[model samples]
Target: MTPTPIAEPLFRPEDAVPMSTDEADVLAWPVAAEQLATLAKYWLATGRASGRPHVMPVMGVWLGSTLTVSSRPGTVKGRNLLRDGRCVVTATTELGDLVLEGDAGRVTDVARQREAAAAFVAKYDWRFGLRDGRAYDDSLPGSPEYAFFEIVPVKGFGYGPDGLTATRWRF
Candidate 1:
């Protein structure tokens, strides 16, 4: 898949805020991507059909322009994503906070699943084996199968630690 092109970061600092107007103060796209790739835990928020919201800490990997996460289809988060693909994924980094607003869909491609699994092992040292086009964690008891979901972010926001620079990135 061709990676999505990210637009130049739009620095939109709050008025009267003590942030530097210099472009240097703005969070760079590469910095955000690096943070997303290295962050250990990310929070995923999904909405139920009835309008209830569910948020959970998930282990995921940022691959190219997509964030890949996994869960059992029977789980609440899984069910919610399967039922309603729209969701938000947020992460906190040492330099800034990141929010990803996108839609997630089930990932059934075996090659992509393998790629995601490799990223998991590289970043988190968690091993996942492929079985019938899905990923299963062999370390856990029963070697539970997981359904992978790929989130293609439509928009993203990055806020600097200093109360100064906020950046909006379009996909």
Candidate 2:
């Protein structure tokens, strides 16, 4: 699937910083996307019904415009996503920190599952076996089942190095 085009993001430098005015210092969208696509680890944050927050490191694949993550339905992150789709996925890159705020919905299509599985294997060298639109770690014992959640970010933030520039994109 093709990524959806977006308007230019709002660039705001914190505390009236002078660096943000330079167009050369502006963080581009492709650079942020590349960092996310190649990132090995990401943090998934979810909120419980009681307003408690849960954060965990998760394996994910950045494909097209969406980020796909897997978790067992019994897990906190999984149950949270199932109950409420709002969540944040974050990662730290060499350039800066990236935050993707969006609603994550469970993916039940087998074809998309296969595509995500292939991307995971290609990126992480981890193979996923699919069954009934879900995936299991192919190399693990007991073959723990995992449900996939895809987040098409409604907004994203990129913090440039050393508190220089803060870029926010609305999609």
Please give, for residues 1-171, the per-residue lDDT of candidate 2 as tens digits: 655435343454454445465556556777888888888899999999899999999989987889999888999899999999999998999989988899999988898998888888898888888876668986888999888899989888888877867677677
What ranges in model 1 sit over 4 Å off?
A: 1-24
Overall local distance difference test of candidate 2: 0.84
What does candidate 1's lDDT look like per residue over 17-93, in tens digits? 46455665556677788878887899999998889999999999888878999888889999999999999999999
lDDT scores of the candidates, listed in order:
0.84, 0.84
lDDT, residue 151, candidate 2:
94
Measured against the true structure, the TM-scores of the candidates, in listed sequence, are 0.86, 0.88
TM-score of candidate 1 on Cα atoms, chains taken together = 0.86
Error of 1 at 119 (Å): 1.5
